[model samples]
Target: MEVLQMEVLQMMTPIEFWRAGFVFWTRAAEAQLEFASRWICAVGLSQRAAQTAAQKATIEALRAASVVPLAPNAISTPVPKRAARKAPRLAASRCRPTAH
Candidate 1:
């Protein structure tokens, strides 16, 4: 990126506008705008959105994913039961227990 910028600066003859860096700067500006929009949305403009169409859609999607409902009323099919745990019985009376 630095090499491209240097090449662009070298090509600027001071008689005309440099075209190459213009493209690069435009893309960088667009990226900064997107980053700022995301930060604003995250900081709660999502609920008070009086902005772009894309921002409104993003807020709606956020709200939809946030809503949660409690326990299910019924199971469509029965779940299989797990096997019972076996007791860990030991014949330890035949030997002395270890001193912990």
Candidate 2:
């Protein structure tokens, strides 16, 4: 458990954790489906409930990751400006910024 926690902490960003969580849930859902189809007796839980529980767990993990501290002064790239006018972009040469 300690090792798992360490590994999860070592991950760079929340997005990476979210992506891994997605993969984990995908594999888990597949495994659950396989098990349900092969087993004759019910596992005392409905298939829908099992899937919902798995999804809930994954979402909780994501939420926890979202709150973890990141760089105090993180800088993000600014979004590019969108054309406001309906005129053709090619014809609107004046609208474009002058290249230095």
Candidate 3:
């Protein structure tokens, strides 16, 4: 058991460990949400209605889980404007056609 633990620790960096754990938890949460949605539908709710309810439930779940939903004004940084450059012109006499 100790040997196995050491091997596992050696296999992943801290970032990788956290990323893997996050992915696992996210997927588990999503599965739970899907199950809840399916259950709602099974309880005689119309498919479209169930889907709408599920979407609201998902938003609430994500908010409770501390996952911030994207909004229109979410960008914190202003985009930098690029300096315009003149396009290079090639001499027609120097241009050569290659046979494909």
Model 1 earns a TM-score of 0.32
Error of 1 at 49 (Å): 5.4
- Give the alpha carbon lDDT tens digit for every residue of 1-100 in model 1: 9999889777877544434444555555555556657777777676345246344444443334332231232222466699999988778787677899
Report the number of the highest-lDDT candidate: 3
Model 2: lDDT equals 0.57
What RMSD value applies to candidate 3? 12.4
Off by over 4 Å in 3: 56-100
User: Candidate 3 on 1-100: residue-level lDDT in tens?
Assistant: 9999889978999998777766765776688779878999889899888887776666665555654554433343466789999998779988788889
Best-first order by lDDT? 3, 2, 1
Instruction: Give me the overall lDDT of model 1.
Output: 0.53
lDDT (Cα, tens digit) per residue for candidate 2, span 43-73:
5667677666655454444344454343432
Error of 3 at 96 (Å): 78
Error of 1 at 63 (Å): 36
Q: Which of the numbered candidates is closest to the native, going by highest TM-score?
A: 3
TM-score per prediction, in order, is 0.32, 0.33, 0.46
Candidate scoring better on TM-score of 2 and 3: 3
**What stretches of model 2 exceed 4 Å from their correct place?**
1-4, 7-10, 40-100
Off by over 4 Å in 1: 1-17, 47-100
Q: Which scores better on lDDT, 1 or 3?
A: 3
